[model samples]
Target: MSTADDTQKTKDPEYLSTLERGLRVLNAFDADHPELPLSEVATITGLSPAVARRCLHTLLELGYVGKNGRRFILKPKVLEFGSAYLHSMNLEQVATPYLQKLRDQTGDSSSLAVLSGDEILYLVHVSTERKIRLGASVGTRFPVHATSLGRALMAYQPDSVIDAYLDTVELRKFTEHTITAKAELEKRLRKIRQQGHDSAQDELDYGIVSVAVPIFDTNRQVVASVNCSTSTTRVSREKLIEERLPLLQDAAIEIELALKKWPFLANSLRG
Candidate 1:
């Protein structure tokens, strides 16, 4: 999509210009660019300098942003927004125990994730105390096409939804193992649908291998996915599947049964 299209959408009367503009400014800072100057923020967000300044100043007044020299950074107060969302969902509280069981059984990191746009959003992650090369925390988002969790979730989605995503997404390669072709990704999703699980190795990050299975709600609709991931050095692809696939699948069932109590989430979290 073109910048014009995005700008046009933001012009709709129902949309709040300040909210959109402020979020754009806030999103300009990420892991790679933790600190950005006003000019850089405007350039990154496609907002004009005047608008960026106004948004930043508004955030500063709201205690969500801080300034050091010419650079602007997100403040700790901004975490309240995420905390509120996570607390309200209660997904972490529900899924952590099951993920912990998988972590303990496999001696690896396990996670629960849900579809968010064309990505998988981590809702809970349980990791061993041992240091690891790769790990994701709650709220981390990863490209759907490159993650087993994403494929497991998508495999259960209607064909039209999957096709819509494939038609719009540009599959960028993160590693040699990443499926950059739409046809290949479609084939993978189909296979996941047949096999009831998905696995990936060096797809998103080198040395990070994972297996994931779709999580279903009370009505049998897939709402989320559960995964166990580890470093390549610690686990072979075959062993990872042999050992953790059952655990992950069982955890999915347990989570599904547990999520029954939260009828709102069971109904609302479907892709």
Candidate 2:
């Protein structure tokens, strides 16, 4: 992509096509694609081979990407970007201790996340040593329609935004319990509003049960979410909620209060 290409695509005259193309190339690499051939990168990013090659060459020179034989792979240097953003926000610093407390109290895994696009991106995750299924960490993304964290943050979105989400996202079922119907999910969101939190049992992954609460900003806007997860074999959905919901709410409140000092951060992450 170039300045000339912008005439056919974006209306912004100041748009930098080279930077956008480079980022598109980088975005092509993900958990499922740890290594991708040059041709594959071009295909995935919808870039011509010449353009993708140029972008990869630049990243390779900058040590942000490495080539292993015929395939391209992201280097540790790329993490500096995400790490810089996390350090700047400082949300993890304020919320991790509370998440740890939730884990300790419930003997389950706890996590912090925010709505990113149509998914919930994990910003912080505190896990128990005893793992069952589906591992997650910072930067992990899951469909917002299938997890407690997703429902918690999404239930508070304005009707227009929620309508846009429903219009855009593909409601694919991850498990038998996953809500794949728009009407049903709309009802669920209403119920979440009536109560104060969201819970999922065998919705995203089988045997996984989690409950989450939305953390709000000073303006009462939902900014992020925190969740505690365990297994269905160990804890029933009712038991999980009975024991963990209040603790999750307390954590959300504490995080909200702590975020007041960093008012910019609260708004920055508002979903």
Candidate 3:
């Protein structure tokens, strides 16, 4: 198999080596191993403990990692790395204005979310004036089984991917309305695929209804999804479909247009 070095040959060797190792160290930590001692980190990344300590110390100095006793763990400040990518994506930047427009039109909270692993990670969010709206934020993570964004993305993924996700991740019940049965979840995903959208009612959090549509890449593959959420007290299912669905669909199309202009996405399209 071709390695990262074979694929990427850059002129700046020093900068490349530093950036590569730093990312490897960050990749060494995840949900299963949220914290690690220097020796463990070295083992995970195949680095010397002394070298690992230096990298961890550098991350600690930058406020990205914190020393919990003798162990190193990621800090909330590590979100800066994700934020940097989100900020650079002009699609997300331009979509913010359009999302705000959707909020103004429907008086509902709207968000841009992407499927990450088995979860939906919110990237951009806009809130409405309603006091009882959905309380999710830009960096919040929600379960794939219970969120509208997750359903929309799943509707477009290969059946094997969806099956693998359901087989691997535990379907913890978040609310009485949440679907825990894998068979039911598969049934719902089929409906979502047929409709090209999803409406999740209080499955994630009580009193919140989330509606989502898939955002497509230039090849018409699902790249991400956009959602509008409102409290059950504020909007009925019929009203949401009648009023907000059009706006969400329009915003998603605009986001697709904006996505095409991004250098990374453009290159991906070419390749």
The sequence of per-residue lDDT tens digits that candidate 3 reaches over residues 1-271 is: 4457545655446456666677789889986899999999999998878878888899889988998899999999978877676766664565788899888888889998778888888878898767663477777788888898888988888888887888888888988999999989999999988888999888987888878999887778787889889888888877887788988999988878887777475343222
Candidate 1 per-residue C-alpha lDDT over 33-131 given as tens digits, one digit per residue, 9 for 90 to 100: 999999999899988899999999999999999999999999999788778867887776678888987888889899888999899998788877766
The TM-score ranking, best first, is 2, 1, 3
TM-scores of the candidates are: 0.91, 0.94, 0.76
Candidate 2 regions exceeding 4 Å error are 1-9
For residues 140-194, write the lDDT of model 2, one tens digit per residue: 9999999999999899999899998988789989888899999999999989988
Which ten residues in a row are the worst by lDDT in model 2?
A: 1-10
Model 3's number of clashes is: 0
Winner of 2 and 3 under TM-score: 2
- The clash count of every prediction, one per candidate, is 0, 0, 0
